[model samples]
Target: MREVDLDVFASELAEGAFAIDVREPDEYRAGHVPGVRTAPLSELGAHLPALPADRPVYVICASGNRSAWAAERLEAVGVRAVSVAGGTSGWARTGRPIVDGTDARSA
Candidate 1:
């Protein structure tokens, strides 16, 4: 799994990069990148087919661990994916915007 700095991740997002958040529903509900898809690690296999294969998907979580694991799994199956180096915390700390709404993931 490749690691990505928040700047690169933000730039990629601005340029319309695809992203997947591999955190559990509860964690995702707390907060996540604005354009990221919620594909929790537990359900990645079923959700993988829904993701675009041609684009680089940014995998993220509260920390970097779960996303990295998801990245590895995606790469193993030939999906182009990378992990956000410090995950959501990094993005939040870097002043990147976040979607402050209800926890949609849990529902």
Candidate 2:
């Protein structure tokens, strides 16, 4: 699976890149990157059809591990996916904005 730093992810996001939060629902509810869809790692398969395959998808989790796993799974299915290096934790540490609660879709 390909990987990208949070900054690159952020820039891509700004350009309308698709992103998925592979963390569990609860963890997602606590916080997540703005505009990211909540598709927990456990339910990735079910949501695959809903994800965009034409563009790069940023897969992220609490740390980088889960995102890496998710990215590999997505790539195996022909989706252009990339793991967010350092994941959400790194995003937060770098002072990136986060949204809480459900229904936090991109504006």
Candidate 3:
């Protein structure tokens, strides 16, 4: 699976790339990159069909492990996906903006 650093991910995000947090709901509620939608790794299969095949999807998790797996799964199904190395923790550590809540958005 392809992997990208937080800087690259953030750049793409600014350009309107789609991103999904594969962490669980509670974990996501704790904090996440702003505007990223929730799609817990547990329910990823149900979300696969809706993902865009034409654009790269950025997948993130607490540290990167879950996002790696999620990225592979997405690619296996023909969706172009990239795992965000360092994940949300890295994004927060870099002083990037984060949104805390259920977000109420869908991808």
- The candidate maximizing TM-score is 3
Q: Clashing pairs in model 2?
A: none
Error of 3 at 39 (Å): 0.5
Better of 1 and 3 by lDDT: 3
lDDT of 1: 0.81
Task: List the candidates' TM-scores in order.
Answer: 0.89, 0.93, 0.95
Please report, in order, the local distance difference test score of every candidate based on alpha carbons. Answer: 0.81, 0.87, 0.89
lDDT computed for candidate 2: 0.87
Task: Kindly give the stretch of ten consecutive residues in candidate 3 with the minimal lDDT sum.
Answer: 98-107
Ranking by lDDT: 3, 2, 1
Write the residue-wise lDDT of candidate 3 on 1-107 in tens digits: 99999999999999999999999988888998997988889899888877888889999998999999999988888889999999999999999988887674555
* lDDT per residue (tens digit) for residues 10-99 in model 1: 899899988888888777777888878788888888887787877787888887888888889899999888988888988898888778
Candidate 2: where are CA atoms >4 Å away?
105-107
* Cα-based lDDT at residue 15, candidate 1: 95
Candidate 1 residues lying further than 4 Å off, grouped into runs, are 101-107
* TM-score of candidate 2 relative to the true fold: 0.93
Model 3 CA lDDT for position 92: 97
lDDT of 2 by residue, 50-98 (tens): 8886788889999899999889988999999999999999999999888
Q: What lDDT is reached at residue 63 by model 1?
A: 79
In lDDT terms, which candidate is top? 3
